[model samples]
Target: MTHKILIADDEPNIVISLEYLLQREGYAVLVARDGQEALDTIAREQPALVLLDVMMPHKTGFEVCQAVRADEAL
Candidate 1:
């Protein structure tokens, strides 16, 4: 099965590069502009891996990572 990867970052440049790299590696890509959106997407999409930015609006990457770890599905 193809793995799903989430790219969570407020910076367009970083998102673009990561999306491209992940896609090139044959993984499905999902994107979020902020930490809250990342968490929501992670819960909904259950991405196999999350590429998160440390500094973002609403919630930080650390917070998002914590939430993901706390979530049983992820």
Candidate 2:
């Protein structure tokens, strides 16, 4: 089974690099530029794993993780 992954990072380079790497490894990859976007993507897509950066605009990775942890859909 292919496991989907959500990537939340502020840097475009990091996002692209990881996107390429994960995709090449046969996993479905999703990218988010910030924490809020990450949270939104997670809510909409419900990926199996999330790679979140600690520092991001609007909300931090900690906040996103908390939200995901609290979300009943997860």
Candidate 3:
């Protein structure tokens, strides 16, 4: 089975590098520009893993993680 990975960051450079690297490694990659986008993507895409940034627009990684942890459906 293919693993879908989500990269949540505000930095364009970091997102680019990580996306390229993960794609080369044969993982399906999805990107979110900020923490709010990350949460939206997570709910929609259901990625297998998430690489979240500690600092981002709309929300922080800690907040996003906490939201996920509190969700019963996830």
Candidate 4:
């Protein structure tokens, strides 16, 4: 099955790299800069998986993960 992966990170290089790699693997890639954007994207798309960086702006990856896990919509 085709799956979508959300990559949340502040670094543009990291985002681009992950997108390229994951896309090459035939997965749809969605990018988010910083934790808030990541959360927003997750709420909007409900991607199959996520790659979150630990030290992001607005909120940390730890916070984001906790929030995502706590989200009933997920």
Please, what is the TM-score per model? 0.91, 0.92, 0.96, 0.93
Candidate 4, backbone clash total: 0
Worst 10 residues of 4 by lDDT: 9-18
* Model 3 C-alpha lDDT per residue in residues 1-74, reported as the tens digit of each score: 88999999999999999999999999999999988999999999999999999999999999999999999775
The RMSD (Cα, Å) of candidate 4 is: 0.9
- Residue 1, model 1, lDDT: 100
Return the clash pairs for model 3, or none.
Answer: none
How would you encode candidate 1's per-residue C-alpha lDDT over 1-74 as one tens digit per residue?
A: 99999999999999999999889989999999999999999989988888889999999999998988897886
After superposing candidate 4 on the true structure, give the runs of residues whose Cα lies further than 4 Å from its correct spot: none
Candidate 3 lDDT for residue 50: 99
Cα deviation of 20 in candidate 1 (Å)?
1.0
Better of 1 and 4 by lDDT: 4
Give the Å shift of residue 19 in candidate 4: 0.8
lDDT of each: 0.93, 0.93, 0.95, 0.94
Off by over 4 Å in 1: none
lDDT of 4 at 65: 95
lDDT of 2 by residue, 1-74 (tens): 89999999999999999999999999999989998899889988889999999999999999998998897886
List pairs with backbone clashes in candidate 1.
none
Shift of residue 31 alpha carbon in model 3, Å:
0.3
